[model samples]
Target chain A: MIANILDGIVLGLQFGLLAAGLTLVYGLGGVLNLAYGQMAVISAIVITLALSAGVPVLLAVALGLFVGGLAGLILDLTILRPVYRLRGEPRVLLSLLLTLGVSFIIDGFLNWRYPLETLSLRIPGEAVEILGVPMRRGSLIASAITLVTFAALFGFFRYTSLGRAVRSVIQDQEGARLVGIYPHRMLRLILVLSGVLAGLVAVTRSMVTPVDAQSGLSITVFALIVTVVGGLGNVAGALLAGIILGIVSVIAANLIGTYISLIILLAAAALTILIRPAGLLGVKE
Target chain B: MLKVKSLSAGYQGNDVVHQVDFEVGSGEAVMIIGSNGAGKTTLFRAMCGLLVPSSGQVFFEGTDISGAPAERIARLGLRFVAAERHLFPQMTVHENLLLGANPYRPDPKTMSLILDLFPRLAERRRQHAGTMSGGEQQMLAVGRALMSKPRLLVLDEPSTGLAPLLAQAAYEALGALRKQGLTVLVAEQQVPLAMSFSERGYVLENGYIKLQGTAQELAANPIVRRAYLGVT
Candidate 1:
């Protein structure tokens, strides 16, 4: 039981970094960006390609950040901005379809170029003792990175000018715009930020499992589940939700099996949807 | 300091206002009176760049800001306050007021000036704006807009959801703002109160201006009385 809990804590912290930003973006924008998952996929692909091309690992990571930021900009220009302009439920539907289509397109291209390969990253996945519990070194590093980034982001939104602007946009778009915050610019920046975060998570994942086209959709499913379960737009809430869900899944995989864990999480999400449409922390609008 | 000529705008792909000509000089208070659905909000929106005008000109301080984005317009010291939807609820009153000054990078002293103008707000600085009384919220809304230190302040229904006395107090504040050399264009449904405070007024019915006169003339117009004020 202890080991199962430890495993959950490890995985939860790692995944929560990606999930928190997703919650904020979805809450503010009011659109589930189906393309969000592939941001991670692209990051992994970029890092791999760069590293394979003899670039230093550090440079390759920077290259991943650049690629992720670029993808985010592209998503904003091609998907989110237009969706915002469309101005109705149609906008939500359009964004959903558009993002799904984008993810598929990216997956198709990656599959065509690379074909089927066990695309995994090799790092020292050594074991370490943490607070008297044994943990994987990769998971420990990923958790630390996630926590550090979240702490930084927390500081930013709480104290900075741009952070307030983002909060204003999230709380009230028109008011934010009225205060001279260009929504398009903020959205672009937020999209980039969200994308970069997902990219970072993918980097952590690369240190664990082999990634492929399938992982894109797979990760998206879990991320969306965690986001909604936490509460649609609450970042801290989403992190908590991610951790809870992560633990559940980890335990289920250890006990019942993988597919059953996925099933249970989906079932709970559906039940939560029926009871509280906004999730745990989202405001009822 | 503000000008709109041949300004026509509406919701996407349709025109609610047509070829409207109006101007508000520096330190002037222009009241826009209209029945509901008569295009007052649309005009205000277009002028402020919230809604893009189909065709027309908007000049501020002699700069052609006709098709600039609303945020850009706001950054240049023209701010619009949609009275009902004004306050950022979750934020503290102080935070909400500070947000009004957001378009500017950050001016420490401007905040004190705004809080000084609305001492009631200062007293309730840490309180959540959403939980504030309607009167206080409206004050916060106005106070927030002033935080930008706007030369031209555009207000939509400043009297909305206010008791007569509260509205009067709100108008008194608006009156004081004009006294301080700020240009104001107010869109109001309350004609008698509006006419009393404003120097010049425009009467709009169904998206077109039907009358332009000094407040006294508008108040005395039989048609305006019969149609708008319900005065027999």
Candidate 2:
């Protein structure tokens, strides 16, 4: 049970990080990026291709991150241009449809080209013992990377002027404008940041399990679940919800079965929605 | 410092403020006074680039700023404080003030000046803006705008939600700023408070400028006293 809980925590940290990227875009720009998972999968594929070409591991990962950021920048500059002209419900709907279309195109292209490609990073080491339970070095390292990223994100948002401007857009767009902070510019910046985060998640996840061309949909689904439970735009809420749902999924799989756990996770999210519609930490809009 | 030529603006295709013409010279405290529904808000919104004008141009410091986006206009040193305040509710008072100086570092001198102007804001430095009382929020709205060290401050209905005493206090702060040579253009429904604060005034009636004169002239005008001042 301790091992399952520990493993769940490891999984939850990734879930939180994934949700943070999705939530910020939605909150700041009202753009629901359905292609978010595709961004991650592409990054993983890039890393895989670079490794096959004999590039150093670190350089390959860096290249993957760059591509991921480029993907986000492209989305913002291209399809989202029309989406930004809209307001309120129409904006949300248009963004959803356009990004979904983009996601399909990416998924189809990747599946056709790299049908058998997958990213699986092998961290060579013995299982490290913690609290009398043996934990894989890969899991330990992934968790460490995720924690550091979260800390960096928190510090950036809390301490930096640029980070505050981003938050100001999310909080009150007109207020941000009154202060000379352009909402569109902030949205573009967040898209790039979110892309980098997507790449990081793919890299970290590959250490635990292989990330493949077909992984996009499931990744988006997991991110959506965590995002809803955490509150749409609230970062801290995402982290908390991610951990809770992670433990619930692991414990359910341990008790019942792996297939049943997915249903249990959905049920848990449904229950959370019924009780707190805005999400665990979301303020009523 | 500011000029409007035949400005007409409104929602959708309908013009709410029509052919409005006014100007404020450097360091002048100008007031646009009107009762409810007199199009004061619409005029200010159009001039500040929050609402696009259907016809006419707005010149700030001799440069045409009509149809410019609000952020761009703000960066050029004309800041608008809307009646709604539009503050970041989840952020602390300090964060709100910090953002008012965006794309530039918050000046220590400006920060100290604002805190001195609104002691209530200094007291609630760490409190979330949404949690503050209406009066405190008003101070914060003005304080946040002032943090930018704007060359001209445009405010819409600053006294909208405040109590009678608080309304007086809000104007008092503006009065103090004007004494410091800050250029201000304010839209006010509370005519008497505005009359005392502004040197020059324009009476806007149904989207048009009905009268333009110095404060004493408007205060003594029979129509102004009857319609706005509530004097028999």
Maximum-DockQ candidate: 2
TM-score of chain A of 1: 0.93
lDDT of each: 0.81, 0.93
For candidate 2, write residues A18-110 as lDDT tens digits: 898999899899999999999999999999999999999999999999999999999999999999999999999999999999999999999
Tens-place lDDT per residue, model 1, B1-232, is 8888998998867899988888888878999999888999889888888788899899999989987888999889998988565466677887776678876655768777767777899899999888899889888888888888888889998888899999998898888878888889999998877887899989888888889988888888999889778999
Residues B1-232, model 2: lDDT tens digits: 8999999999999999999999999999999999899999889888887889999999999999999989999999999999999999999999999999876899989999999999999999999999999999999999999888999999998998999999999999999999999999999999999998999999999999999999999999999999999999
lDDT of 1 by residue, A10-107 (tens): 77776577677577677677667887778888888888888778999888888887888788888888666678877557877888998999999988
Question: How well docked is model 2, in DockQ terms?
Answer: 0.92
DockQ of every predicted complex = 0.62, 0.92
- In the predicted model 2, the residue pairs found to clash are none
User: Against the true structure, what is each candidate's TM-score?
Assistant: 0.91, 0.99
For model 2, the stretches where C-alpha displacement exceeds 4 angstroms are none
Report the alpha-carbon TM-score of model 2 versus the true structure: 0.99
